[model samples]
Target: MELPKVGSIGEYIRQQRQQAKISLRQLAAQAGVSNPYLSQVERGLRKPSAEILNQIAKGLHISAQALYVQAGLIEDREPDSDVLAAIRADVTITERQRQVLIDIYESFRKENRAGNPEAQPTQPAEPPPDAAVHRENTATPDSKEG
Candidate 1:
């Protein structure tokens, strides 16, 4: 079969989507665009605005610059390094706190293994051996002859 050309931004969206092996309906759902509009765009009958292009780019898991390049808006540029750096910086968690959280999570997992429902009411702790209950008869004790 002859391959379709990647001619415009819309065509690029369709091409990338096909390359990713995602159905047009799935892409439309992910991009929050209607199926008919996506089809029209893919056929080059409609051109989406930059904001919509960004949505398409996000749905395709690609940078907007790549889409712009494919649309003949500008030459291709490398992905933004600052975006990654900012993400790494935003995850400012300390190792100690992370380990503590992991330990607490594992403890809860153990409770789950012991058949505890997540929101069930808990029972009180068992009493100590010395604190065990005992029963006594009300009648007087029998006396034995020595």
Candidate 2:
């Protein structure tokens, strides 16, 4: 697999931190690193170790595996399911809560699949072609309403 370009991981980290609305000094304090070190990492002036990456991940409330993949320390795997992505993206939930929900969801999906050997996995069904037309026909303008 092609390796990520230099500073890509730093860019990813910066993006995540911004998305999380965390300050550099706050992150550094949480990750137990110096502010200058974290700044250097973000600027690609320094390459952080895996352990430091893990600490930063914890500080950002994200998975270390995600950072590892971004840093090209690990291979990117299959994309997560919509449900898994939703759970992981929810900032209101704690990391432990997210893991528990994901585990439960996967277990239920596995059980459902196991019960029916020939059943296909569920995907969203497309709306019928005429559905939009029907809605347009039924919808009334303000002037037409009683």
Candidate number with greatest lDDT: 2
Residues forming the 10-long window of minimal summed lDDT in candidate 1: 83-92
Worst 10 residues of 2 by lDDT: 131-140
lDDT of 1 by residue, 1-146 (tens): 64454456676677678766788899889889999988888988777777778888778776676566556676533235453323322324432343455457557756877888873446888878899667885555565434
lDDT of each: 0.66, 0.80
Root-mean-square deviation of Cα positions for candidate 1 versus the true structure, in angstroms: 19.2
lDDT of 1 at 103: 59
Residue 32 of model 2, lDDT score: 99
Name model 1 segments beyond 4 Å from true: 1-7, 77-146
| lDDT of residue 77 for candidate 1 | 38
* Candidate 2 clash pair list: none
Model 2, 1-146: lDDT tens per residue?
65344666787788778877899999999999999999988988778899999999999998898789777788645455778767655656655677789889878878777886555467789998777753356555865867
* Candidate 1, pairs of clashing residues: none
